[model samples]
Target: MTDATLTQTGREPRSAGALIGRRLLRWGLYALLCLFALYYLLPLFVMLTTSLKSLEEIRTGSLVALPREVTFDAWGKAWSGACTGIQCEGLRPFFWNSVMMAVPGVLLSTLIGALNGYIFAQWRFRGANLFFAFLLFGCFIPFQVVLLPMARMLGIFGLAGTIPGLIFVHTIYGLGFTTLFFRNYYVTIPHELVRAAKIDGAGFFRIFWSIFLPLSLPIAVVTIIWQFTQIWNDFLFGVSFSSAGSQPITVALNNIVNSTTGVKEYNVDMAAAIIAGLPTLFVYIVAGKYFIRGLTAGSVKG
Candidate 1:
């Protein structure tokens, strides 16, 4: 028999009946996915419409109904004029506070993690595994368990209630996870490159800076996104480690959302929530491409 005939007989390629069933299954799956999308997006749509509507409209109409009249005044007020505590200057200052805290925390933690990972990956001395074990253990330790000690330490350094203190807190807590990210990712990288660079008379930092750092893009994206999101959205650390004018956006939003002594301004509250969230959302939307790369970058062992 010819090879084509033999193949067709042995494997009886999918029949018309099977193909029709598969097409039906696929369309059914697509319909389910569309339903799931609407399920999640419905709340967001309601919030957007409510935020744009006037107080009277919100009071008189259905919560999920589309706004009859849209206005951007609530957005403007949320940005620059809303009351977040006694400070009636809006969420801008707190927003900047979060930006300042998150940026430095992410940078410091990521750099330290890269160095620690390189050390663990390349230069193993005696007791290295033991030390690395302890370091990894930090990743699982609950922050609440150490809060008192951390507060005392901050006070000792006169960093209590300061921006620097908040940065230090985030960096310290963030290090273990970032280190794990880089360490696991780097293990998949071949050590032959390091050996080759060493043969060229490159020192440790020289080889790392020139050779490995360039290839660190995928893991770096993962690290930055992880750290930025954690630090930006942290309410506990923001409230605990910082106070007054130095609180991050999360803390400010909480105060505004829960404030007493006024008729509840639901529209402003929704707008403020959106403003507080937009930065991290923007970051994710912009760098989401890197997230996919990061997930798969360490899959292959070379």
Candidate 2:
């Protein structure tokens, strides 16, 4: 018999009936996905509509309709001049401060985490596994437990109550989680690659910089997204480590939304929340594929 006939007879290639069933199953999956998408997106739709409404319209409580007189005033107020407190200014500065904090914190934490992961994966030095066990334990420990000690350490280094202080705090806090993520990922990679690099006389830093980092795109994207979200959205740490001027956008958003004596502008508050979340949203949308792909590659290979 011909190879083609043999192959066809062996598996009896999927029948038309089977193909129809698969098509129906795919359509059902699509329908289910649409429902989930709608459920998750409903809140954003509400927020966008609410942000466009005036206080009068909001008080009238039309949660669904567009305002009769659409206005960009809320957007303007959110961007140019609005009061978080005595200062009636837009969230521009706080937004910028958050950008500043998140960028450096993301970069440093990813670098450290990648290095630690590489060392743990390749070196096999004495006490290395024990050190990693301690680091993993650190991930479950609550930040609140270390708050006082972290504050004191910052003071000792003269970094407390400053932007640098907040950056340092975020980096330190992010280290454990990022390290865990990268370490787990690196463990999935083949040690043969590192061994080959070493056979080529590549030293530790050279191997990491030239070989490992280039291959670590997925894990790096995951690390950046995770750390950026954590540091950017962090209110408690920002409040603790930063004073009034150096405070991040989260603190500003809080002060805007929560006030003792003033009526809250829910529209502007929602706008501010959206604004504060924009970077993380953008990062996730942009890098999300790599993030998922990285996790998939790491998990399935081992």
Candidate 3:
């Protein structure tokens, strides 16, 4: 064989071996990731299976085992019939309570944040940085620190222990986060847009409504997801600020899980936990990709 032919033939085996090694490494990584996914998902799997089981079957079977006979009685009870203390009313009312509070809270905070972001990013007024710094400070305040003052404010407003009260509280608390998100995102937009709008005699509100708001979808998604998840899952504020009737589903779920009145209904507890968690889960499942995209979109400038 020619020398070139021999050299070419000799390289083939090494190349093939390298390719095989890469394939094996890739498959190993995939397997490792799958194992980790299963490990993290184990609790949710157990909760779903346990919720489907009869108490007798749960006692008899392994914790990780699938149900012998599937039933949604626990789900039904959790939604409408489960007892929390003296009240047997399930999570229905409280679920609606959360929806009412979260929807308005997310909208209000996002809208106000968008406006604040617009001003901070493009308006460039005096003392803007100082005010923005104060907002940044607000973001770091702990939930416990605001409990007393916020409670007193709610009392003064006569909104104590009401759904609207919860809405107001979440909106106010979420403002810092929403404003920060929008400000960072808005900074990424060219300032020329605002200037061009101003040249067209567009007033502040007009320019924001016509130009900025339309381009706000990405950061808005991020802000909405953040606020909704926070507000929906909040237990401290829900419990501390609301009466029994106005409590959010998180509080109700806690009540259901901790209720000591009867033969501990493990199935109902699991189901209730899942129910309380479903909205946020659904939100994440649907908008999770958008959330990542939005975060990356704003990350370039801020």
Task: Say which candidate scores most in lDDT.
Answer: 3
Q: Residues 1-302, candidate 3, lDDT per residue (tens digit)?
A: 11121112233445777867866766676677778888898999999999999988988899999999999999999999998888998899889999998999999999999999888988889999999999999899999999999999999999999999999999998989998999998888888777888899999999999988888888899999999999999999999999988989999999988885757888989999999999999999988998999988853441
Candidate 1 per-residue lDDT, tens place, 1-302, comes to 11122112244437899866766666676677778888998888887998999988989999999999999888888888888777788888999999999999999999999988988887777998998899999999988898899999999999999999999999999989888888888787778878988899999999889977877888888899999999999988888889797999999989888873567888988998998888889889988899889978764444
- Report every candidate's CA lDDT: 0.86, 0.82, 0.89
RMSD of each: 6.3, 6.9, 6.8
Tell how far residue 128 is off in model 2, in angstroms. Answer: 1.4
If scored against the real structure, what TM-score would every candidate get? 0.91, 0.85, 0.91
Measured by TM-score, how close is model 1 to the native structure? 0.91
- Candidate 3's C-alpha runs over 4 A off are 1-17, 298-302
Which ten-residue region of model 1 has the weakest summed lDDT? Answer: 1-10
Q: Stretches of candidate 2 above 4 Å error?
A: 1-38, 260-263, 299-302
All candidates in order of lDDT, best leading: 3, 1, 2
lDDT of model 1 at position 129: 92
- Give the lDDT of residue 6 in candidate 1: 16
- CA shift of 245, model 2, Å: 1.2
